[model samples]
Each structure stands twice: as structure tokens, then as C-alpha cells.
Target: MVTVSLPTPVQPEFDTTIHRRKTRPVPVGTVTIGGGHPVVVQSMINEDTLDVDGSVAGIRRLHEIGCEIVRVTVPSMAHAKALADIKQKLESTYQRVPLVADVHHNGMKIALEVAKHVDKVRINPGLYVFEKPDAQREGYSDQEFADIGDKIRETLEPLVVSLRDQGKSMRIGVNHGSLSERMLFTYGDTPEGMVQSALEFIKICESLDFRNLVVSMKASRVPVMLAAYRLMVKRMDELGMDYPLHLGVTEAGDGEYGRIKSTAGIATLLADGIGDTIRVSLTEAPEKEIPVCYSILQALGLRKTMVEYVACPSCGRTLFNLEDVLHEVREATKHLTGLDIAVMGCIVNGPGEMADADYGYVGKQAGYIALYRGREEIKRVPEADGVQELINLIKADGRWVDP
Candidate 1:
């Protein structure tokens, strides 16, 4: 009998890092997504594109606070033309900011016009080549489906060629709520429908020799959103497509639940190494979304833009008020970027638990706290001075920076 060699089983202990999916680099202004670049953060301004002054200020505010790419809606030809003034004003007053124009619903002319003013253009697959809903229709015949596909190709070609010639990129954004009538009839309201929707547009762009594409599959419900993106990645892998992805949960509402909901979907895919850029869509000010996006990236160790605090939950053995000390420590060290600081409740688990931190504060006894520099006990200071002492230790080690 011939012997068969078995594949090696995975050792999870050695698999500590997230290996991002391989994607070709797609440029958006000066920033590049995928191709092993640090995951990019993006947000959209709510200002109307026609309000040139307001739009310029809005884009500048978001970009100043670490939003790499900003998108503005272009619902009409007037709004599309305004992007030229907005782009010029941004350069003259502020700095050159990467802008994307969102076009929808028979928007070919608007897209071609706005393509001249922005670094990238985003088109919805379901709406770009609008197919008026037929109330009398049962389902599309195979011939009718092919007919619509041809119409889409004819409409999309000019915009594709314009962006390709300019070396700009395009986002084939597919929303679950807006699947085309034909796509819905063909694949039903499901993740398969979403994947097929993006794939059709991608193939069209590929045929035109335009590959600077980013794809998004967004749904209001987290489960549907998650399934759509995962399915898209699987389909792209099989087809040898290396386009980057833009991750978000559409209509993620406002307040605590919104942040949690967006995080649950975006972070889950990010952990699996699926997304190259992300936007945390919230109903609050556009500025509010930037911090949430950075927080998600930081928590995953994908990008370190802020100080990392590792604090233990208080137990009966906790010496001092763990909550109060943690707050104080955080306030002092929050500006120290790329540093990991730990605050522990007591000695029982403090040193052992915080072994990986750059610096740690542990309660050693009543009215006293011990400081650590990577598992080595530095000194014990009075609890009242613990926060200041931690700051001093960080400064002594040359890691402190003024806020």
C-alpha cells in the first residue's frame, strides 16, 4: 500500500499576528491602500458639495484629525461641478486633501464631470446604470439580463476610461438595500446577490484595463454585512482578483449601540485580515467617526496611534481604588504614543499579568504602590503620589511627550 502524508495541524500559539490578505496597491491621492500598507482610516463630511466654503472647511477638519480620505456626495451636475472650486479652495487655504465624490442613480454624466475634480469616484453598482423597476415583471429572462449587462458596460466605459487615464481609483460600493431589480430577481436578497453585484462591475472594469478599484459590501444588519464581505473575499480569491476593500456597516445609527454595532462588524473582518481601509459611519459629527476608527485599529494592533492602557478589573484583593488610579494614570500618560502602560489592582497578579507592558503600576500595600519597568519592580511610592510617580518613570525613561 502507498503511504499518504497528512497535512500538519495548526499550532495556534504561534499564530499571534494577523496576516492581512494580499491585495494590489490602489492609490487615493497621496495615500495607498493594501499592498501591506498600514490599514487606512477614512470618513465623510456631511456638508453639501455645492456649499464650496463649508465643504472645504469640513474636509480640512476631518483630514487634520487623521481622516486620510474624505468623501462628498454628488447628487446633481451642479454639485458635481462644485468639486472643482472645493478642490482649489482646499489647496489654496488648507492643503491638498484627497477627496472622493459619491455618484448614484443614472449618474454617468455627473461621474465623468466630478472625475476631473477629485482623486477618486465611488459608484453604487445597483444605481449607476439605473434600471427602472417594472411592476409587471416576474423575472428577467436570460436574454434580458444580458441586455441590461450590455447597457451597464456601455454607460460605465467612459467614466472608467476617464479615471484610468488620470490614474485615479474607483470604489464599487454595493449596498444591501439597493440591489438592482435584475440582481434581486436573479440572486434574491442575500449575500450571494451582493457578491455577484460587485463581481459584475469588477469584471467590467477589468475588461477596460482599469484595476485601481476598491470594493465595499455594506448592510444595516451586521450579520448580512459580515456575510457579504466574507463572500466577496472568497469570490475574489477564486477569480485571482487583488482589489482592496473598504469596510463599514451602512446606517449604523448614533450613540453607544452604533459604535458597538459598527465595531462588531468592521473589527471582526479586520481581525480576519480582510479590510485595507475602514469608515465608522455614525450619525454624529463626521469628526466623531475618526476617533472610533483609530480606536478599532489600535485595539487590533494594526496601527498604533495612541497610548495603550492595560488595566485589571478590581477584585477583593485590590489594595487601592483600582478605578480611580487607572483614570489618573491614563490622564497622565495618554499623550505617550506607541507605549503600553498597565495599572494593576494588587501584587497577586500585577507583575505576572503586566509582563508585556513597557511600564506598570501595581498596588504593593496599604497606602503604597509599586512601579514596574517591564516586570522588574522599580520602586514603591505612596498611593497618593502614584499617578505623578508613573509620569516621572515614563519621563525618566525618555518616553514622555507633552500633550
Candidate 2:
């Protein structure tokens, strides 16, 4: 008889402290937001609402550049109709990318109309009420303010319920410029006020049993934006509601300054594993936002398997045109994925620094380059063919090369 042996149970490998916050998953079409899914990056198309063709064209452009979610403003009934047609075309062409309708007010009517078309709705709760500072200054009573708040809540109630019944997702996007005057007065015009405003809306959604929701508290000021999100996270934890947080610094300027501001604020939250989606709002074309968002996520290690280029800054000891070489390599390999390449000025520290990269090229004597893969010298290539040689090696490894 053969001896029988019992199998030993497998043991846990290692202990890690990096636990992602538990969140309720909300789906916008096929893309799942929150609940441990990879954080999504989204952008809004800045096309005229009346120009349906232009808007559709913009959507196509955004899709080509990897915008997972696109938001277009539906301000009027005509815009809503345009959205319906646009949605039909988008569904047929780009089925995977989801469209979100941005509705400011008239929630009851707009929500009912747009709910049939778009995958998600972004409501600015602040825009629900029409604030008249002069009227309030005329000795408005506390009861009147309370009544206004109640009315605003009542307006949103049926709309929220209708959308929930229709099984659509909603985002309560609160902006600093549009806060209710009453809340600003109650909590003061500070970061705490922003948090309170967001919480109030979130509680309203929860009261309606609409848990498939995302929340954003955006302020143009960096300090205000940072403080508000930190406070909002604490408040959400206290409430025991795990809705996914959408992170962005709203109206973050146009060029390098805007990129820096957005990256700084978003990087802080992502490093702490707090945000579930990111939007790098810039004043430039919406297509530009996609790459910036990806770059931010890539730098944070939240995104795995992308071509990462590390080039050293040229110093006095540099032997060649390191700047020009680095630029050429970066531009040529911008779209390649799942590889790490480095361009260094010198072989002494260059090869050693890029020891873990899949392939690298270090500058040596005039018009010569030292190619490497994980500290081992692969071959020598001319300076002109250095980048091409690296590309060929990467392709030989069966990684996709962008044409």
C-alpha cells in the first residue's frame, strides 16, 4: 500500500500596513469607481452646449486621449436634447467611455430628462438656491433662512429618488464660489464651512438611500482645497459612510503653474490612499488633462506597468549633449507602455542608478553609448542609434511599442 501524506495549509506571506479605505462601489457604465478599483481619471469637454456636432467632436477627441469619463454641461432644454443625441452616438462609437451630465439647477426637470441618457449626473448643490444678499440684508429672519434650506432639500429629494429608482449614479459637486449664503454664515467662510456643506448634501443623499454617490469639495485656493478634503475625510469616517471621494483643485490655472498646483494637491491625497478618482482641471484643452493625470498617477505608483523614463540633468562633467539626447528619447517613446528606460549623462553613476530598469543607455566617449539591462552590459550603440537600439530591445521582449 502507498503511504498517504496530508497537505500543509498555506500561510500568509507578509504583513502590509497599506490598507485602502473600504468604499461602496459605484458603476458608471463598465468603469467601476471606488470599492478598491483603480482610481479613475476624468475630464470635461469645453464645447458650446448648442453646438451638438462640435460637442460630439470634442467627445471623440477626449476619448482618443484616454478620458474614461466625460462631462458636458446641459444648461437648457435644448442642451438636454442635444445631450440625448450625443449620448446615442457616443454609446454606439465609444461604448466603454461613460458620459456624465452636469446640471446646475432645475434638478427635478433636468434630472428626469437627462437621467434617460447619461450614465451619471454631477449636481452643484450650491446652485439650487438663488441668493440675494440685498434681500437678506433687509432683516431676514432665522425662520426664513431655515425655510430656504428646507425648500432646497425638498427640491432635491424627489429628483434624487427618481434617479435612484432609475438606477443612475450622482455626484454632489460642491464649489466654493457657489456655497449657500446661510451655510457660509453659519460655519463661517472657511474650510470647515466647505466640509459642512458637503456633509449636509451627503447626508441628504444617504437619507434617500442613494448610496451610489461620489462627492467632491473643490476650492480654487490650494490651502482651502487641501484643508477641506482632509476635514471631509474625517467627517466621512465619523459618519461611517464610505462614499468614494473625487479629488481635484478646481480652476487650477493654465500652464505649468496649474499642473504643479494640481499635482501637489492630488499627490498628497493619493499618497495617503484617500482619493478614488482624480481630475486635473486645467485652463488648456481638455485633451491635455489626460496625460497630466496619468503622469501624476504613474509617479505615485498607483498605476503599474508603464514606460518610465529617467534622464539625468547635465552637469559640467557631462561628455555629450545630454539634454538633446534625453529629449529625443522621451519624445520618441512617449506612448510605449510597460517598460522602464533611463538616459544618463555618465556611465559611472548612470548604469548603477538605473540598475533595476528593463533597459538603459549611458553616455560614454564622444558619439558612443553603453547599453545595459539590470547592471549587465548588453551592447554598444552609436549615439544616434542609442534610442532606437533600446526600442528594438524592448520590442524583442514582446512589449507593445507605440507606432
Best by TM-score: 1
* Over 4 Å off, model 2: 1-19, 93-96, 135-145, 304-306, 400-402
Candidate 2 lDDT, 9-74, residue by residue in tens: 899887433355678899887788899998898999999857877888898898787788888888
Each candidate's TM vs. the true structure? Answer: 0.96, 0.90
Alpha-carbon deviation at 68 in model 1, angstroms: 0.7
Clashing pairs in 1: none
Write model 1 residue lDDT over 67-139, tens digit each, in one string.
9999999999999999999999999998999889999999999999999999999999999988899999999
lDDT of 1: 0.94
lDDT of each: 0.94, 0.81
